[model samples]
Target: MALAWQGVRALARREWCSSWRQPAEWLTPLAFVIGVALMFPLGLGPEPARLRELAPGLLWIAALLASLLPLPRLFAADLADGSLEQWWLAPLPRPLAVALKLAVHWGWTGLPLVLLAPLLALAFGVDDAAPLALSLLLGTPVLTLLGGLGAALVLHARAGAGLLALLLLPLQVPVLVFGTAAAQGGNNAPVALLLLGAWLAVLLALAPWGIAATLSLMLD
Candidate 1:
């Protein structure tokens, strides 16, 4: 257990340093989210009520799209540099390693989106940004986990980016629906939040193993 944690910390440190060096990897998605939020008011006109009504869906969609921008690079760097091969031979389990890496990936890519969501929600005229913020808090990690699986599956493909979006967007629909509903904060908001939490739990349980298996097959 101690050794596993040590490995996780080491992997976390390495990933953090790598992500820090490449500003665009983390920054582009943030910029995309902001751009999408800003564009809606221009396109839809400056009605706070209408914008507030639409804010939940628009913000969730932006977050969903922005999450994709960083995914292709998730495993590409490790795979290219032979770090994944070393991981295969390490004492740590592949699924655990995948989860750890995804956790770090979420820290760089998903965390910013979560942090920025409330501000975007306000910009969209949401009366209370708390529900939107709460929804994103539970939802972004799921996005990162699903994205990691998608990234691993398409890592070797020539047009992996396009394929990643295609594969991931459909799977993300449930999250989109529930997250938007939760952010909208109706009588059903609690239900939606619960469902979102359930989805997160389910994905966390399954995604790492799926990613690990996919990478193992690719490595073999």
Candidate 2:
């Protein structure tokens, strides 16, 4: 059990290291957060009060968009190198392997942005920072689950990562709606977070089987 988890961690680290070498992969998420947050002030004419009113909405949008940026390359590179096939051959349950991969993906991406939410909220004039931050925390895993689905689906894409964002963006609506609504005008973001967690649990349970079944059919 411990060894399986250790392998998962190692695989995730490899993904992280590979991505780190190609820094361009991060530009969209970083720019999207800063740019969208800045727009709140511009769109609301820089009135602190008005900016505060829209802060929760703006921050949630940024977080959602940021989380969406990495889905393409999340598994594409590994899949290209046959690492994904190696994972399939591991002695561990393939679903467990998929879950570990998702966990690692979340650890590298969503988890950091969640930790950075406070600064982003401030930039967007979010007076009630807790809600936006909490919303990000709860919602990012949902992004992972659903986004992982998108990532896995597109792992074989020849357009590479270019079309991934286009493919996955539409599927992110529910998370954004619930997440922003939770942060809109209040600090009670727990319910939305719960929903996100539930979504993640469902995906974690099902992703491996789905991926394995797809692979088996492809191999046949």
- For lDDT, the strongest prediction is 1
Model 2 steric clash pairs: none
Q: What CA RMSD would you report for each candidate?
A: 1.1, 2.9
Measured on C-alpha atoms, candidate 2 has an lDDT of 0.71
Residue-wise lDDT of candidate 1 within 112-156, one digit each (tens)?
877877679878877688899899999999899889989999989
The regions of model 2 sitting more than 4 angstroms off are 1-6, 19-23, 26-28, 159-167, 185-190, 215-220
Q: Write model 2 residue lDDT over 69-147, tens digit each, in one string.
A: 7776777666667887888676677766777777766766777677777777787666556766677777777777777
lDDT at 109 for candidate 2? 70
Give the poorly placed runs of model 1, Cα more than 4 Å off.
none
Q: What TM-score, computed on C-alpha atoms, does each candidate reach? A: 0.96, 0.81
CA lDDT, candidate 1, residue 149: 89
How much is the lDDT of residue 99 in candidate 1? 90
